[model samples]
Target: MAKSITQEFVKGLWDEIPPFRLVLGLCPVLAVTKSVENGLGMGMAVVFVLVCSNMLVSLLRNIIPSKVRIACFIVIIATFVIVVELLMQAYTYSLFLKLGIFIPLIVVNCVVLGRAEAFAYKNGVVASIADGLGICVGFTLSLTALGALREVFGSGTFLGMSVFGPSFQPFTFMVEAPGAFVCLGLMLCMMNLAGNK
Candidate 1:
């Protein structure tokens, strides 16, 4: 049975949330999530690339030869990745620099490539778009949440505004690599617990 467009979109928010549920795209989820700004910026760039790439791949699916489909899909994804990179560099140079190589790494991100190959290449344009939006939004939300958790405990701020008293002692560990891992693990555990309910 085929899913409705709404179902496709809704599943991504929870059932198939890329980082949390699917456990895909952990590199950016772990690396750039030190602050909400980095996570959100990375997420927005991915939203643009994934949605655009999915649309293009779906539109060109029939014409793309089966033998060259993967290559063709990479080319499609890479084009959008480049567009995202250029746009990021121009408008948000500082954030772009902070994200660094991770921005370009979206071309190879399994989330984008997997959707293109698995969904977009086999689905209608509208369904593909829905899938892209749903998955990207879920990813953005996950990143932002993780970033917020880290930022608040690690830095005592949310997007740079202090959320606690001046005397509050930041955990300090929450902003480091180990802290990211611990936070992600705790989140994963919590999500599992919630899903079980």
Candidate 2:
């Protein structure tokens, strides 16, 4: 059966969510999510790259040879990633510094490449756009949630504003590598339990 455009768009939000459901892009998810600002920045970059690449891939699906499809996808994805990196550096130098190498690394993110290979190449422009938007929104939500959790518990602040009172002691661990894993694990567990129920 054919799926409606809305279904295609909606599925990526939760059903096939990139990080939490599909678990495709963990590197950026875990790395830049120490703060909501960093997570949102990285998420937007990924969205721009993903949507642009997906659209291009869908547009050229017929012309690109199957044997070199992967290379074509990488080139398309890299172009958008570069654009994102330049834009970030120009407008948000602090975020650009915070994101560091992860910004450029967006070119190699599996989420972008995977969508190109698995969905965009086989779908129409509209559907590809929907897929890209849906996936990126899902990714952004996941990153923001994780970042907020870490920021609140680890730093006693939310997006740099203190959330707890003066006497409230920060956990500190929630901002560390181990904390990221633990938080992600617990979140995943909750997601699983919710889905099962």
Candidate 3:
């Protein structure tokens, strides 16, 4: 049975969440999630690239030859990535600096490319938009939630504001590389447990 538009949009939230469910795009997921702000910024950049590329791929699906579809998709994705990079440089220089190379790396993010190859390339414009928006929104939420978890515990702050107040000692390790792996592992374990139930 074909999924309704609502189902297409809603699946990204939980059913197919990139980092937690599909487990795609772990590079930016683990790297920039030390702070909610960084996670949100990175997620938003991916949002722009994925949505625009999905739209364009859907539009040109027919004209793009099957033999060269993958190459064409990369070109489309890379174009939007450059646009996002430039926009970030202009308006969000601090965030651009923080995210650094991760911004350009969006072109290769599996989540974005997978959606293009798996969904948008075969769907209509409206459904492609819905798919892109849904998946990227889910990704944004995941990154933000992970970032918030790490930030609150590791830094004792939420979005740079101290949450635990003075004298509250932070774990500190939660912001480190090992901490990211541990936190992500725990979250993945919990998600699997919940899904199994």
Off by over 4 Å in 2: none
TM-score of 1: 0.97
List, residue by residue over 1-197, the lDDT tens digit for candidate 2.
Answer: 19878998899987999988888889999999999999998999998999999999999999999999999899999898889888988999999999999999998789999999999999999999999999999999999999999999999999899998899899999999999999999999999998988
lDDT, candidate 1, 15-86, per-residue tens:
999998998889999999999999999999999999999999999999999999999989998999999999
- Arrange candidates by TM-score, highest first: which order? 2, 3, 1
Best by TM-score: 2
TM-scores for candidates 1 onward, in order: 0.97, 0.98, 0.97
Among residues 3 or more apart in sequence or in different chains, the pairs in candidate 1 whose N, CA or C atoms overlap within 3 Å are: none
lDDT score, candidate 3, position 157? 96
Q: Tell me how candidate 2 scores on lDDT.
A: 0.92
Q: Clashing pairs in model 2?
A: none
Q: Is candidate 1 or candidate 2 better by lDDT?
A: 1
Which candidate ranks first by lDDT, i.e. highest? Answer: 1
Judging by lDDT, tell me the better candidate of 1 and 3: 1
